[model samples]
Target: MMSGLRRGPLASRFSPSRQAAMKQSVKLIVGNWKMNGLSAALAQAESIREAVGAAGQGHRVVLCPPATLIDRMRTALAGSGVAVGGQDCHEKPVGAFTGSVSAEMLADAGATVVILGHSERRAAFGETDAGVAAKVEAAIAAGLEPIVCVGETLEQREAGDAIAVVSAQVEASLPTGLSERDFAVAYEPVWAIGTGLTPTLEQIAEVHAAIRAAMVKRLGESARTAPILYGGSVKPENAADILATPEVGGALVGGASLKAEDFMPIVKAAA
Candidate 1:
């Protein structure tokens, strides 16, 4: 266990109902389409819905396509046991920002979840931890589950700062509003996303354990049950091993998610 994570009465005092709920918490498998996905992709979404319906329960599956496909995918996947989500949302519910989508708008468009603070957003658009916290609050207010992301680059890992850096990001980026709401945290090492490389299971376990400790310290016992998802170059071939890692509550898949044949195997692994 990481420092400060030793169980105290507070951590061990969950009620019978809460204990059962925690034990039954389903694995969450999310597919992030990112800047890919067009209307034509709805077919893939339908196929996944069909597969998951046959696969039965034991896990939760969500698909986050570009904003353009949120509504269409939601409609197509209706009653199929799959959920639709947005890639990002503005912290404010409404504004003249012209090009930004708000959490309320995402909810209105049929998105039940929103991904915030992805490394791409942080590195490319200069998003700060405070900014992600603000967005988390907005998503909660709008009734959308937020999946807050945090990670370190190769240089930071090489410098032996991966755990510390990611721990700090988890502390700063997650808002208190998330304490009672459904949400997830995704750890996607900047160096591994789309690189066809992955950290050893030991490394993944280390970071995920650190993240869980950070979450519990910040949010108390309620944080203990929230899923901590792994992301990067996740695919069917490696999904089982990664998902089997201790503290890994699920996966956040990228390119491989674009096709049902590729994505379903990962979901099956979680199931």
Candidate 2:
């Protein structure tokens, strides 16, 4: 454990072995349940927890279930290797925003991490780069690590501007005042998500390298080592190769993450 770091309610709940694993600076695999999951799905969480615990590997694992499952999953995964998180959060801590959940609420619900600036949110809700930066600030303030996503569209790739588009998004969406300790970045191409399609290994390496260079320039030197994850149609067959690529720190698993049976192989690949 880092000296002078207080074990808050969230940290206090973690088992010693799990806490030790959290201290390591290495690859991380996070599951974004994305508006899916229910009370019964806790069983899946249990299975995932057991699988990770038994493997006894060093890679960090997180499950970002829907907002409703955050509290329960946190409690259920207590003293286990799996950490819990929220899929998204509003910039404000509190408000009358009827259906929106804030960074503070996610923390209060026991989330240690929160995903921000995903392409889906940007496209569906028209979330601006400025808004994502604010949400990043809010997430850090609430003691939740933020995984800010930056990606390009199919059209941009076809136009031969994939590198430029993602570079700009990384510069704009990721805020200043961050370090290796608190946040991560995901390169999830908007075109490939759930399309059963993915960028080539060479293509994935190119973007991740571009992202790393952009992060080093945008967020400073610490970002050179900051986790840069790959998302979009991540599955067992391609996971080993994807995780093996240069600058490909880890993955943000989508559909495969909903079930331990599917997600663990990816974990094995990372391990």
On lDDT, the leading prediction is 1
Query: Model 1 segments beyond 4 Å from truth?
Result: 1-25
Error of 1 at 181 (Å): 1.4
TM-score of 1: 0.92
Tens digits of lDDT, candidate 1, 95-118 = 789999999999998998899999
Looking at model 1, the pairs that clash are none
What TM-score should be assigned to candidate 2? 0.90
Q: Looking at model 1, which ten-residue stretch has the lowest summed lDDT? A: 1-10
Candidate 1 Cα deviation (angstroms), residue 170: 0.5
